[model samples]
Target: MSVARTLFRLTLLAGALSPGLAHAAGLDGSQLSLLWALPFAGLLLSIALFPIVAPEVWHHHFGKISLGWALAFLLPCALWLDPATAGGVVVHAMVDEYLPFIVLLFALYTISGGILITGNLHGSPVLNTGLLALGAACASLMGTTGAAMLLIRPLLRANDNRRHNVHVVVFFIFLVGNIGGGLTPIGDPPLFLGFLKGVSFAWTFSNMLLPVLTACLILLVVFYLLDSHYYRKEGVLPRDPTPDNARLGIQGVFNFALLAGVVGAVLMSGMWQPGLDLNVLGVKVGIQNLLRDGILLTLAGASLALTPTTLRDANEFNWGPIAEVGKLFAAIFITMAPAIAILRAGPQGDLAALVALVSSADGSPINPMYFWLTGSLSSFLDNAPTYLVFFNLASGDATQMMTEYSATLLAISAGAVFMGANSYIGNAPNFMIKAIAEQRGVPMPGFFGYMGWAWVFLFPLFVLLTLVFFR
Candidate 1:
C-alpha cells in the first residue's frame, strides 16, 4: 500500500484504540475523536518517517503541521452543535463574529499604507531603538498593524546598509506587533473582542497603561543594547547624511484623523443599548443592533474612503497579508464552529472549572496568578474565547468589583495578547511578520530559535510585569 494510505489506515486504527479520543461528548465527539486521534497519530508517525521519506516537505511544512494539530485538538470540542444547526451557526460566526475583526485589521492595514519591512540597514542603533519604542507606543493608538506599517519602511531604510540588524525586525515584532497594542481596543483584536463581550470599552485604556509603559521601557533598553552592538560591528552609516527628508513626515494627516474616528467607533461599540427604543422619522429601531453592526461597518467603509492617494502612493498594494489572514480565519471559522457551541452550552460551568484549575482568589478580588496563567493559555487557544471564558468565570457577578477590578482584568487580557508574540504560532501577526520578513530575504530564526530570543530576553520581563503589576 502507498505510504499516505498506510498512514491514514493507522490513524483510523489509533482512533479506534485510544480511549481518550473515544470519550468526547456526543455525535460531534465521536466525529472529533476519529479525526483528532488518527490524523494526529499519523502526523507523529510522519514526523518520525520524514528523514527517510520526505525531509524537504517536512522541513517547509512543519508550521502547517503544528496548526493542523491545534485544529484537530480544538475543533472536536468546539464543534458540538448538531450538523443540522451548524449552517446557521457558521453563518453567524462568519458574518457577526469574525467579520468585524477582519474589517478592523484590513482598515488598519490600508490606512497605514500597507508598508511591510524585511531588510537590514545602517544607522544610529540608539536612534533606531528609539524609533521602535516610539513605533510601539504609537501602535496602541494607531493599531499595532498600522504602527507596524508606518515604521517598517523607515526602519528598513535606516538599517539598509547592514546584515547584522535582524534583531531590529524581531524587536519590532515584539513591540509593534504585540506589546504596543495593549492600551486600547483598536490596538489589538482580542481586546476588541473583549469590548464586544461587555467588558467596558474605556476601561481597557485606563487599566492597561501601566503594563504598556512597562513593556515599552524593557523593549527600548534591550533593543538599544542589541541594536548598538550590531550597528558598531557592521559600521552601517546612513547613506544620505543630509537632514532634509530625514525627519518623520506626516504624509496624510487626514488619514490619521479618520483613524482616530475608527477608534471612537470601536469604543462606542461597548455601550450597552437595549433593543428597540429609538425612532428615526417615527420608525422604531433597535439601538443594540446599530451599535453592534452599524458602527464597525461604518468605520470599515470610512477607512477605505479616508485616503485619497494612499493606495496610489503605496504602489500595487498586494493583499498577500490580508489574503493569508482570510484563509486562516476561514479555517478557524469552520474548525472552531463546534467549539463555541460547546462553550456556550454552559459557559458558566466550564469557566468555573478553568478558573478553579488556574487561579486562587484572595478575599474580594481575584488575584493575579489566575489571571496570568489563564492569559498565558489563552495565547494558545483562541484568545477571544479564552478571554471571554475567564471574563465570564471571574466576573460572574460583575458587580462594582468587576468594574473596579477592570484595570487588573484589562492587564490580564493585555498580557495574553502581548506575550502571544513570544512564539511564532502564539498570535496571527507573529507568523505574518515572520513570513513577510523572510520573503524579503532577512533571515529570521527557526521556531525553536525564535523561542530562545523570547525566553532569554522577553519572558523574564513578562514574569516581572505579572508580579509587579498584575499580581
Candidate 2:
C-alpha cells in the first residue's frame, strides 16, 4: 500500500514536469488582456457582495462559488494558454504559495484559539486602552486573526456593562485587527505574502516600525478620549451582565510558547538558506520554507493534543471561520496569478495605464501614489492581493524593492496594513471581529455603517501618515 501510494505521488510529480513548467513563472502577460482578470474580479465581487446581496445562498454555496471562480480562471488558462503551463501554474500556486500561507494561518488560529482570558476587568478608559495595546502587540506575534479572536471576547465582557460601547469594538477592530499587524509579517496575511516573495522578515519590522507606531499611538489616544467621553456620558455603568470576583487569568498559557515557536519558525525560514530546493512544477520549494511549514503544523498539532478540548470550548472555538477562509482564499490565490503576472509585466502589459498612474515620467515610482492607491483599494478589496498587486507593480524584483524603491515598498506595506482599518471587510479579521461583537450583543454597525465610523476616525490619520511618511 505504501509503495503504491509513493508510486502514485511520484508519477504525479513526474507528469507535472514539462518544458512549459520551466517558464510557468514567466508567463507573458502582454499577450494576456484585462478580460483575463474577470474571474478574479468576479470572485472578489462574490466575496464582497454575495453575503449582503444573498446571505443564505452565499452561506450555503460559497464553496461552490469559490470553485466556480477558480475554474473560471483555470479552465480558460488551460484552453487558451499552453496546457502544460496552465497545469504548472496551478501546481506552483498551490504548492509554492497557498500551502505555506494557509498552514501558518491554520497553526496560529488553532493554537491561539486554545487560549482563553478567564476573567474580565472593568472597561475603564485606561483599562480598555491597555487591552487594545496588548492586542496590538499580540497581533504581531500571533497574527491579527489569532490576536483578535483571543482578546475580543474578553474585551466585550470588560465593556458589556457600559452603555456606549459600539465605539469600543469599532476601535478594537481598528487597532487589533489591522494597524497593529503592520510591524511584522507574522502579523498579517499581506505581509506574510511579502515575506514569501523574498522581502526579508527584518525588513518588514524595520521599515514598518515608524508608520505602525505612529498609527497605533494616535489611535490609542483617540480610543482613550472617545471611551472617556462615553464613560462620562454613561454617568454610572450598567450592572455587569456576567460579573465575577475571580482574579483574571489565562487558560492554555503554553500556547504563548507555541506562538513564539511560530515566530522562530518563520524567521528561521528566511535566514537559514540551505541552498536546496524541491523542484515541484518548476517552482523551487525551499527546504527552509518546507521545514517552517512542517514545524507550524506540528505546533498546531501539539496545541490540539496538549490543550484540553475544554479550553477550546470555553473560548467557543470552532473550525467554521478557518474552513471558510481556507476555501475562499484557495480560489483567490489561484485567480490572482494572472493579476500578479500582469502587474509584473509592467509597462508592457494591459495595466500599462495603471503602471503610469504610480510612476513618474522618468519611470521612477511615485511613493505617495503607491500609498493611496494601495490603501484605497485595500479599503475595499482584500489587502493581501492588493499589496501584491502594488508590490509587483513597483518592481517584481524583491532586492530592488528593498533598496532602490525602499520608500515605495514602505508606502505599499504601510498602506496595506494600516488602511485595512478603513472598512469592515478590508481585512479578514475585521468582519470576524464585527461578527463576534454583534453576537456578543454589541449592536455592531452594518457594512456601510462601519465605513462611516472609519471615515470619521481613520481617514485623517491616513492623511497625516501620507504627509509624514509617503510624502
Candidate 3:
C-alpha cells in the first residue's frame, strides 16, 4: 500500500477504536502500565533480529513492519486514552521531531554524496591510519554520514589489495562513523536533536572535546598498531591497483561550499531566533527552524543541480539508507511516545525504577550510570532517541542542563556519541560504512561477530572513560 493510504487507514482505525474517553491534555504516564511498551519492544526486536534472520523480507517490507508496530501502539492508545490526545502525540512526533531529524540527515546525505574522492593511495599502515584520522577529523565538520560516504570508497580502494583489511573498515566505523561526530551538533543526529531542543551548538564542542579527542586518539593508535602487525604478517605487498604515479584528487568540490551553507544555516537557526513561532497540533515550530530546514533543502538541491552527475555516479549515491532511516525512525518516534512520556513522568511514573538507575541513594545524579545507561542503550537502539530519553530523564530544561547539571549533560552526550562505535547498528553511518565496505569486498563481520570486536577493544576503553571522566 502507499504510505499515504496506510497513514489514512491507521487514522481511521484509531478514530474507530476511540472509546469515548474524556479529552486528556496529554498522556498521564504515571497511570500508564508497562504493557504499553510491548509494541516498542517488538519494534526493537524487529530492528535487531529481522535483517539477520530474513534479509530479503526485511529489505522489502521493513516499512510495513514498522507501520504495523506503530499501529499496535496507536490503536490501543486511542482506545484507552483520548483519540485527540493520541493524534496530537502522532502529530508532535512527526512535525516536531521526526521531520526535522530526517530532513537534516537527507540534506547531509545528498550533499555529501555529490562529492567523490578520486584516485587511490597505497594501504600501508601509516597511510591507512592517516586516512582514518583525516576522515575522523572531517566527520564533525561535515557529519558522520557525509564523511563516511565521502571517504569509505577511497579507503576501501586503498586497502583492496590487502588480505587482512577487515580491521581497517571496523576501525573506520569506530572512528569516522561514530566517535568523531561527537564534537558538534551538526556532527550527528543525536547532538543535532539536542540542538533543536535548545542545547547550544557549541555546547557539544566545548564539553565533548577532551573525551572525543581521547577516544579518537586511542582508537587511531590501536588501529595503526593492529594494521602494522597485519601488514608484516602479509609478507609481500600486493601489486598496486592504481598507477604508482597516480595522485589523489577530489571531484564535485562545489559541494564543499554547499556543506558550509548547511552549517551556516544550522547556526543561523540557533543564533538568529526571532521569537516568532508556529504551533502545529500543540508542538511549537519556530520560524528560524523552518528557515533552517528550507536552507538545508535548498543547499541539497543546489548540490544536485551544480555537481556533475558523473561525480554522484562515481560515489554510488542512492536513496536507500535515508529511506530506511526515515521508515524505521518514523515507527520509532511514534511507538516510543508512551515510553518517552513515561520517562518524563520521572519519580511518579511506571519507569521510576529505571529513572532511579541514573541517580544515587542520596538522590544525586549519578554521572557514570548516566554514561553507561545512555551508552549501552545507544549501542543497540538508535542513539538519537536514546539521548533524548536520558535528556528528558535528567532534566529537559536546556539551560539547566548546560549550567547547573553540566557534568551530567556531558556524561549523557559522551555516552550517546562515543559508545555508538560499539556496534554497527549503534549509529546510521556505521551500517552504511559496513555495507559499502562489504560491497567493495572488504568482508565485514556479521552482527554478533562485530560485537566481539567491540567487546575486546571498545568496552575496556568505555570502562576507563567512566572511571576517569564520568565518575
Candidate 4:
C-alpha cells in the first residue's frame, strides 16, 4: 500500500481503538492535577529552546517534535479517560478550533503570495520611516503577515546599500509585524480568534484605535529618530541599486480584491449566523463557519489558478511557514486543552493560583495584570492560544467582555497583539520576517538579542499604554 494510504489506515485504526479502551468518562479540570500540564510545558520549551540549541534538527523535524508532544497528551488521555471522551476531545479540537485557524492562515498565505511589489526606492531616513508607517497602516487592511511579506523585500532592497540597517528591520517588526496588527481582527491571529469566539468585527478597531495609534506613532517616531542618527553617522549616502529611472509599481494587483473577499467572508460568518450547525464528534460546526472556510479555500484556489505563477515566484512565496504553523498549532491546540480547561475551571482548578493572580483580593479584575500576564506569556508562547486562555480567565462570554468587562477585553487584545513584538517567537510573522531578512543578508539579532531590543523599546511603551489605557 502507498504510504499515504497506510498512514490514513493507521489513523482510522487508532481512532477506532481509542473508544474501546475508555477508562473514565471525561476530564474534569478541577479534579485533575497539575501533572496534566506537562505536555504543554514540554511543547512550549521545545518551541523556545530547540531552534536555538539545535537549529538543524529543529529545521528538519520540529513537526515531529510537536506531534510527539501531542501524543504525550493524547495517549495518556486515551488510556485514562473514557474512549468516547478522549476521541471526542481530539475530534472537537481538530474540527472546531484547529481547522478554521489553519485554513484562514492558508488562505491568507496563498492569496498574499500572489501579490508582488517589484521596484525599490532609496531608503532615506524619511523614506524608510514612511514605508514603515505605510506598512503599519496597511497591516490592519491586509494583515501583518501580508504587509510584512509584501513590503519587506522592497524595504530591504531600498536599504541594501546602507551600512547600519539592522535597526530598520527591527523597527519593521516592531511596527508592522506586531503592533500594527492591533487595530483589526483580520490584522492578527489572536484578534481573529477573538472574532471567531464572537467578538464583533468592528469591536477591535473601535476599542483598539487609540492604543494601536499611540503605540505605532511612538514606535515610528523612535524609528525615524534612530534611522536619522544612523543616516548622519554614515558620512556619505550609498548609491541607489535600482536605476534612478526605474519606476515603482505593484505586479499582481488583482489579489487585492481576493484579499477583500477573504475579509468579507470572515465578516459574513460573524454577522450572518443562520442558527444552523452540524454536530460532529460532539462539536457544533456552524454552517456560517463552514461556508466561510469554503469561501476562503475557493479564494485561495482562485489566486493560485488565476494569478501568474511567475508573480508568486517573484514574491518568493512558499508553503513552509504556513505548514510549520499548521503542524505546531495542531499540537498546541490539543495539548493546551487541559490547560484551557483548568483555566476555565477558575478558582477550583489546580491552576487556581495562576488564575487568581489576575484578580485582586476584592475579586475585582485587575486590568493591568491582565495586560502584562497575557502579553508576557504571549511573548513566549503562541499569542493566539494565550489570548484564548486569558479570555476565558477574564470571563468567557463575548458579550459580557464587550460590555461589562470591556477594559479587560481591550487589555487582553492589546497585550496579545502589541506585545507579540517582544520576541521573535511572539507572532508568526516576526520570525519569518527575521528569516527573510537574514536570507537577504541582513544581520538580524539572535533570540535573546532581539528581546533586549524589545525590552529597551517596547516595554516602556507598554507601560505607558497600561498607565493611560489599561489602568
TM-score of 2: 0.85
In angstroms, the error of model 4 at 175 is 2.1
Ten residues in sequence with the least summed lDDT for candidate 4: 2-11
The Cα local distance difference test for each model comes to 0.58, 0.81, 0.82, 0.82
Error of 2 at 256 (Å): 1.1
**Candidate 1 clash total?**
12
lDDT of 4 by residue, 109-169 (tens): 7887788766668889999999999999989888898788778878988898999999999
Over 1-471, each residue of candidate 2 has an lDDT whose tens digit, in order, gives: 332233234335534657447454445777789888899889877876787889889878888888788778877877887666566666666676667877887897888888888775888999999999999998998788778877888898888898889999999999999999988888987888798789987899999998999999999999999899989988977777665775789989999899889889987886678999887556678899889999999999999999998888877777776767677766776777787677667778998787678988887989999998888878765688789889987887899999999999999998898889987657778867776676667887766678889999998998999899998
Q: What's the C-alpha lDDT at position 5 in model 4?
A: 37
Where does model 1 exceed 4 Å of error? 1-81, 85-89, 114-122, 193-202, 236-253, 272-316, 336-354, 361-366, 401-411
Q: What TM-score, over all chains together, does every model reach?
A: 0.71, 0.85, 0.88, 0.87
Error of 2 at 11 (Å): 14
Candidate 2 clash figure, as a count:
0
Q: Tell me which residue pairs clash in candidate 2.
A: none
lDDT: worst 10-residue window of model 1? 22-31
Instruction: Rate residue 135 of model 1 by lDDT.
Output: 84
Model 4 compared with the native: what TM-score? 0.87
